[model samples]
Target: MADNSSGGESTFTVLLALGANAAIGVLKLVAGLLTGSAAMLAEAAHSAADTTTEGLLLAALRRSGKRADRQHPFGYGKERFFWALIAAVSIFVSGGAFAIIEGIRTVLGEEAEQTLAWVAYAVLGVSFLLEGTSWLQAVRQVRKESAAEDLGFFAWLRRTDDPTVVTVCCEDSAALIGLLLAFAGVGLHQLTGSGIWDGIASLLIGVLLTFVAYVLGRINKGLLIGRQADVRLVRSIRQRLDGHEGISGVVDLLTMMVGTDQVLLCARLDFDDALGAADVERLCVRLENELREEFSDLDEIFLEPVPREDPDIRARVLERYGENPLSTRSAPGGATRSETPSGE
Candidate 1:
């Protein structure tokens, strides 16, 4: 559910990575076969894994965009998160595991003659250029998104609901580092006439891939478990609700990121007591329309009218916030109207 421009950027980035990794994978495989360098072979597997990851990301973008249906009233936004999780697993199994096993085999087996050391060096040079190109594109997209959100780069990354860009960026970064490790292994093996250095480089590449996989896996796991929406978005919504005229107080506000740019929100509000039921219904309809106009990401909303001083409600809010709940007033029946400044 990312906006049109954002969704287009994500697709373009994935395609660029897919093309780069596909070409690099072929080149690395040829070089590895000719030189018998475990590190080079590991790099080849790494490229293959990256290529697969890009494909899966493409599917994620496509499927997650599906329109809402009977069974899935909330739509298919979380499909992106599910596929991203699978892509992380692919990195570990196809790339990391293969590299570790190959490293062990080469280290324990007989020495391999470095016939095409020059070929590996040439491939590495070209691969670096390709990978660098892909990496720059990902970085540019990340920076643009961060700026739009008025947040720092790393902060945006942590809070971003989109997974395709993150997946591509991380994969490309690991690819670049793996290339360097392969270069070192190939260079050292040729210089010393020992495959041990080559095996060591392969092991390092495995560890690098494993770490990337773990980081990505943890992120997607949190998303699948339903993380809260962006802090800024939540705070803005709360502030808007507080300033509304008829709304005496906001009892509870809940938000969840259902998809890349889609949010599900529920707000329990205390309206003016003198208002009639018909007036309250009209206000509810108007408020929903106004909120949707202001916040395009709000995909679904539920508004409940409740007394602000309800004991059970107060108790539940206290348990969640532990004294600093996101309400206009500090306590029940405290401030008649909100005096706290915006962004509190």
Candidate 2:
């Protein structure tokens, strides 16, 4: 057992991003209307979509924090993932799809006056600064999560379970890049006296949004279905178990995310040869306490004591349960001695 809890860092981050996007959306809408800039209009629509998705993400964080009940023993952690997936889908349909269609329409239309193109550029400059601010916040969180480890940003993004964290990061990065494209498109159109360059910028923004939406959807879907913690976290847990005096070593350790900030840990431990049943019980309690203190994200823990080097019994257990018996797939009758705690 461990202290089951979640955090508010994700909510705070989403709130900041939402405010930025809301302001950006308003600015783009006004600029697009005044100048008839295709890129500006597409960016406005994209900002609108982002605002809606962030609202959904905030709702998810709220729902997933609910306490567990009889019918749902695992609590509502998956709700966060469900909303996250919806957010990704919305990004594709509302932002990416809409942008592509707008780009095509603009590409085929007649040239507009370059008189107000300057307004679009001004809006883009401001939007880029705001988006960059949001992105910096996301990157800071990632670095803190990795314990100051200098892993690549993409690698960390794939490994993290916090949907809001990655969503905000990806969205902000896309927005900054989009602002650049818009600027280039407007600049080229102003210099060349053609609308083709502006349309091309809209096209590029749409393609970029589509790709980012795809990545977010795939990652969130995995979390929604139940994904294990990263390999690095698992190895770290193993090290902790190995260092404990009463335990010989960890035979196997497995983990799965039940919520954005909650994880369930299950492990088979090999007790020291001289420890008795009472000693084993006390050791289990002590180790669990240690783990809870060390890993605030852990919500639950199941420790199964067994001999680390017992080949005969290990083979039999493996044959019956396949992998990770804690997942509810077990031998006939749905209960077995090997599945029992401490080889009882």
Candidate 3:
């Protein structure tokens, strides 16, 4: 889950990438036209794709932030995943496809003489600087958010619910590498007087963009389908439930990420047989309030009182967690202890 600060950071990152890509795209177009470098043209397409992606991401952020209404009881959080998925498709279609086609045509057709090569070089250098600035901003945001969650950078990225920052980071990183590939293509063409290197460079850039698109697409797909909340958060919730005085044991716990910073949690617990109906009702209300206060990301919660030793429930838990599904014990302080559940 993300915080308000992370959301702001994501917006800033997207805006920066948007500005840089827009400017870089125009420059690359001009340079490609003047130089007749296939790689330069491919890079121009890359920037165009990135610029369009940024616009879609802006829409994602805005639409996904809408408040829940009758039409969408869970809010519009999944809109972000949908838009991000579209952006990935845009990258592959507009950028990778164009670059690949251009590369093939240039390689097979009559080799055109590279002209005004210096212009391509100048454009690539400027584009690198702008893309690098955006990349750095994205890195800073990811680092801060990952640190807040007490997870390694890559681990956090893989599990993060926020898609805006991840998309920006990946696009800018690809842009920078594409610029380097363009530079190499131009330089080699000028030295060897062969457009083959330029074509090869374009092919490589296409492949790179395709790979990035695939990775992001897979991520957004899983997210849109629904994924579990952070493992640490799940563990913390289970520990709290196990330690509660009224709860004899936890039968089952379930969680899902509903939005960028929202989670839905459901817990089945075994209450003490001594507690009356009124007491159990009060305890349930108290637990809901307390859990929400403790973990701000818990947007929705449901607690069900159940018998811990029910055969049906025990079988379900066992099916999910193997033989040791009930990893419960008593500590020296008379506190209930439980390990991280396998369901998470």
Candidate 4:
């Protein structure tokens, strides 16, 4: 199961980003028209794309939470990754591509006077405020989750392996940066009467968005393709299995990430011969129970036992029979071979 609190918090943050960006996108579109600033237009496109992505992300989160079925034994966790990839693509196509085109047009001497530079400034300020709020919320969630995992915020973000949160955070941060760039461009164009500065800013914002999209895409791809879990976690599980009673040794272990925090474990244990079949069964059960108790994220556990006495079973039985061979006592009548043994 996922961490409900964290998931909910992340979902809330995404919704906030969506709401904020939707409003900001409208304002930016108006400002872009009023000022004819390429940078403002690019910012508007970026926010619009972000809004769409957030909506998709929320849908993905819901779909990914569906229970496993016969057709999908591993559940629908990858749905989140799939939607995150879609979000990245949205950013690239809607935001990056638009920005690039607008920038190229502005660079090609398409000069439009900033009829409403003040309007752009006002919209950019509002955009900054909204994006900042969303970004702060995302950062807070990351900090809280990372602290729980004993990792720094950025480290946790990188290591989390959850595409939704990572993508959302990246988008929010990029939006914030885009807002700053848009403001700078508009300000420079107003100050120097040079639309080229605005064009350059648009180009830079496009580059930033594209880079962010690529990063998000890579992360989601890894999750979709089933990346391996942390080695430390696997080692910890192996140590626990090795230390269990009735387990002679841990021969092998395997772990796989089934979801954000869920894992499947397979372990091979060597058991002493003196341990009975019933004992082996009980040990396996207990070990699985303990593992579940210790690691709530461990979803399934398979334990195989190697018996210690299979090689000497017959020899040991024969030796025991020889040592206690029937008590030979002298019978009242002269001992016959059949009567030689009193007990058998």
Candidate 4 lDDT trough over 10 residues, lowest sum? 335-344
Q: What is the lDDT of candidate 3?
A: 0.89
Q: How far out, in Å, is residue 307 in model 2? A: 6.2
Q: Any residue pairs clashing in model 2, and if so which?
A: none
Query: Each model's TM-score, in the order given?
Result: 0.94, 0.79, 0.94, 0.84
Count of backbone collisions within predicted model 3: 0
Each prediction's Cα lDDT score? 0.89, 0.80, 0.89, 0.78
lDDT (10s digit) by residue, model 3, range 6-32: 777788899999999999999999999
Give the C-alpha miss distance for residue 17 in model 4, angstroms. 1.1
Could you give candidate 2's per-residue lDDT for residues 105-193 as a string of tens digits?
A: 88988777665887888888898888778778877776666544455666767777778888988998898889888898888988998
- TM-score-wise, the better of 2 and 3 is 3
Q: In model 2, where do residues sit more than 4 Å from their true spots? A: 1-6, 109-115, 147-154, 242-249, 270-283, 305-344
How high is the lDDT of residue 56 in model 1? 93
- Candidate 4 structure quality by residue, lDDT tens digits, 186-230: 999989998998998999999999999999989878777766566
Error of 4 at 218 (Å): 1.4
Pick by TM-score: 3 or 4, better one? 3
